[model samples]
Target chain A: LSINQVNEMEYEDFISTFGNVVEHCSLFAAAIWSQRPFHGVKQLHKTFCDFIDTLPKLGKEGILRSHPDLAGRIAERGLLTTESTKEQLAAELNTLTPEEKANLTRLNEAYKTKFGFPFVICARDNKKAAILSGLEARLENETEKEVIQGVEEVKKIAFYRLLDILQHEEAEKLIGGW
Target chain B: LSINQVNEMEYEDFISTFGNVVEHCSLFAAAIWSQRPFHGVKQLHKTFCDFIDTLPKLGKEGILRSHPDLAGRIAERGLLTTESTKEQLAAELNTLTPEEKANLTRLNEAYKTKFGFPFVICARDNKKAAILSGLEARLENETEKEVIQGVEEVKKIAFYRLLDILQHEEAEKLIGGW
Candidate 1:
């Protein structure tokens, strides 16, 4: 939808449209619902991010942990959200060789054993090899370092997801002033 | 550290050691510090993840947004945290060909334009080709789908990072009961 159209949306309508952008955490949309009539997609995006930034540490970690593991049990049981399924597919994670799957499983277990949560990466932005190597390599970091890294990755994911919601060809043209 | 050592650590020592694991957000360590005398590494990891899960959404997103972009301006300025710098290097994002760099620049801009933040992937988990292709393909996703996908990736990054912190040989043996 056009930025102008978004700006005109009622609060509930706005939430309904943009609330799901950050996974099941519609609270982001709910929190920012009253700040409607965003100047454009940029403002809208900024508002959501800013709101998230303002949350306490515990809340932020919850959102970070809310995501599923890459090709972990959630994916195996076909329990991932639709978007996750597609993103994993794009990375070709669904077609792993047995060795690759075993490796991933090992990495996932190792990663979880250390970090207390599943390993997360934008699978669509990586091939399985990269993901596997990343899993193996990051296993050597300190806990403090890893937690920070995890959150940063989550933000990037959120940012891209927000863009997907806001940017269409026409909206991109308008936002880019094309 | 061994689960036994972790279990014996004073509250201050525990936070001091593990506090920075989640970036500037030390609350994870702080909140869980009192729940000390962890039975083992598995229990320790569980405590941390469980604490994170208990947080409200806003707090969770804050943690998610705390991370720096992979190979974005922060890295260009040489201001990424030590771990991030190493992780990006491991992925070889710092050594892009000029053409590849330009492509990355273009993709980054397009991605940020479409999304509100920089694209995030676990660089250490991907090759340049995978990163580039992942960036290129994800641009076609709808906003909600992308947001979910992005957060999922961030989670993977965090999971690996956590593993890095918790998975020392001793702890692994303890957790694995080997």
Candidate 2:
């Protein structure tokens, strides 16, 4: 929906549409707007920052529940993706030099052991080489910090995607002016 | 590591430790210097943002590769300590009336179908009731736009997390001067 529509939405409707955006992004902060009719995007941005600052304090149970189970084929394959990449990653997985494959396997195991989850990176934008390099480098991070940093990295990639989706000048103006 | 240690490290080392951060959160912009050290927190912050603003435009594939997976369980569960209410979302999810659960389920499916992914909200500091209410509202967003907004929310959350991890300022100087 257009920003104009968003602005004009009934309090309930606007909140609903906006909330879905927040939910899909895993943004708990923006979804919980204490007051409606946000003064403007600047106010909204400030509120957004204040909310994100508190995520690290969540205990282990909270963090675990926050993660989705990577079950079934997805568990084996690592993640779901477009058909092309699925084929590409599969092919690359096959062709890895025995050494490269071993390193990847080692990196993968180290990453999971350190972080308590798969070493997930947004492979969409990266080539196989860059992905491997990133995987190797991140394996060195102490688990606590890596977990925090990895989540943030995921958030950044998600934002770029959001900008792509929203062509609304008003939304841009909201962010730009803010 | 302490902010002091971060400051003491060579430029390349600093980048290595925090490069992923700059890569994902700082807009993919980099400023390479043959022989200049980041002298202080203010200088570092400015350089970081400058580089971020200069990030090369990413292609669709590149953009897609940038985002990490959403914290689904976190969105559905977790305690939003940042909010005054200190809300527990999992409990709220459990308490969802049958109708609410159905709507959420439908919304989740619709959101994923349209966006090619599940709805992601950065629920670091929100109350559970607020999130559920938001999920109910946002499900109505057009598929494309909702995804866009979700990514943006994710970016803002990531930026905040970056600052937390890279504490460039000396606490005494930061607070005392402020």
Candidate 3:
């Protein structure tokens, strides 16, 4: 839709259109609903991000914890969002060996025990081996460092998600310059 | 931070420690502060994720939108979070040619115009060519399909980020089955 079309959308219409961009977080779309006339996808993304930055700490954490673990039971049961399912499949998380699955479960348990949250990471960016090593190495971090690290990882995930929803072909154009 | 230690932490301490695991969202830790005696990281992660699933749509979106763009202006300016910086670097987004940078800008702008969000993808999972091609190809998707696609990409990123922060060495053990 054009900027004008977006600017003119009703709250429900806008939310319906953009709500799932953030997973289960439609409120983000609603919050930005009033801030229409977005110059383009960048402005819209900025508006959404700005609002997130302004949220209370509690609100922010709530958002962070919303994501399910990679290769977790939720994912196995096919309960994850459609986007999540495909991403995991892309990463071959859906095809872990029995031994690999057991290993992930153990490491995931250990990481959470040390950090008090799931080990958050952008799985698509990593092969299973890298992810395993990462999980092992990060276990040594202090709680403070891990939290900061987790949040940063979450941001990367969100950025990619935003790109997916926006369907920006320019991603290649931006990178290739071909 | 063992379950016992986590149970014993003050609210402020808990949030301070685990708050950033979800980017700027700290409320996740806070909400689950009282749900101590977590069996392990998997349980802790589960608890946090379960709480998130229950959040209003707006809250979820806030979390989703908290991320900065991959190789976007923020990353270019080195303003992205530490975790993000490292992830982008891993994908070699930091080394784009000037022409590539301009192309990214163009693609980003076009994507946002159509979908009202940034173009998100797991940079680490892709080389520049793949990313560019992905951007080009995905532009043809309907908005609804794209939103689902976008969120899946975000999940992949988060999964990798989780691995980065948690640092589980058992990854090798699991892979090696040593």
Candidate 4:
């Protein structure tokens, strides 16, 4: 949908459409709706960033915790949210071998044991190799720094999800006019 | 676990054990871990209450929205988080007739339409009758009043969840000492 279409949406429609733009935290969409008549998707993204930035450390950690582990239990069970599934598939997380999956799992467990939140990366921007290596390397960072990095990744993921909602093609516009 | 046990837990163990105390807003657990070595469950409960109180209106609404509707889709699909499944079953929501379920679905949609969040009640403290009647009456409330009331219910639910954690029987203590 176009930014004009977004700005014109009712609260419920806006939420249902853009809600998962931040994963399960539709509250971001719901909260930001009041700040609406956004200049464009970028303004809306900035608004969400501001809202997220204001959250306390615990709140940010909770947001991080809400995310499914990359190629972990939720993905294995086919229970990922629609957005996560698509992103993970794009990154080819669904195609890892058993040995590769075991390696990622070991690193993921270690990372969570250290930080108390899952390792979150913008999987859309990274293939399975990058994710595995990133998790292994970041496992050694101080929790404070790692938390900041993880949240930063969350923003990148949310940005992609936002683009997914806002992208409109010429053909789509023509179809929409029907 | 005893209050003493809760006080001494490492951060990861603490989050795993107590995170769901606020439904999906585990950040409450994650954040409050810093204020730890709580005097007792009551003190811990008080800490959570204070943390929640500090949230802005939007934050509280986001918290409320994280809850599943009583007798709603998650329940129908048997996908409730373990805590929710127990609470809803306690309220006998699982046994609702199809007509009753339809009635609740209608009221729930209306409630969300009005307030932009779900109708939340502490199901363990209420039967299906109370929930239905409460949702019906609360639907008439102004959005501001209802938000306050809904959050109040969330706190009550959280309190009960806290007790479930702290309540250890004498026999259980015997088993643990083994």
User: Best-fitting candidate, measured by lDDT?
Assistant: 4
Question: A1-178 in candidate 2: lDDT tens per residue?
Answer: 4433444553324333443222122223223333334444444444443444433322211222223222213434755333323433543544566677667777766665565555545444555577689888877888677666655544433343333334455456644331
Name the best candidate (by DockQ): 4
By the lDDT metric, which is better: model 3 or model 4? 4
Clashing pairs in 4: none
Clashes of each: 34, 27, 58, 0
Which docking band does candidate 2 fall into?
A: incorrect
Query: Per-residue CA lDDT of candidate 3, range A42-152, in tens?
Result: 667777777666554444544545556779877878788877777677678877899999999999888767655677777667778888888889888996677667666
| Residue B170 displacement (Å), model 3 | 46
True contacts kept of each: 0.00, 0.00, 0.20, 0.27
Between candidates 1 and 3, the DockQ winner: 3
- Residue-level lDDT tens digits of model 4 in B65-164: 7788888777778888999999999999988889999999999999988887889998988999899999999999998898799888888888778877
How should the candidates be ordered by lDDT, best one leading?
4, 1, 3, 2
Candidate 2, position B157, lDDT? 41
Fraction of native Cα-Cα interface contacts (under 8 Å, chains A and B) also present in model 1: 0.00
Global local distance difference test of model 4? 0.81
Model 3 stretches with alpha carbons more than 4 Å out = A1-4, A167-178, B1-178
Interface RMSD against the true structure, candidate 4: 3.5
Tell me the tens digit of each residue's lDDT in model 1 across A28-144.
665565566687666776787787666555555545555677887778999877667877898899889999999999888788678665577766567889989988988888866
Where in model 2 is the C-alpha error above 4 Å? A7-30, A35-49, A59-106, A122-125, A168-178, B1-178
Candidate 4 residues lying further than 4 Å off, grouped into runs, are A1-16, A95-102, A170-178, B1-40, B65-150, B164-178
lDDT of 2 by residue, B111-162 (tens): 5555444454544434445666666576678754665666554443434444
- Please compute and give the TM-score of the first chain of candidate 3 against the native first chain: 0.81
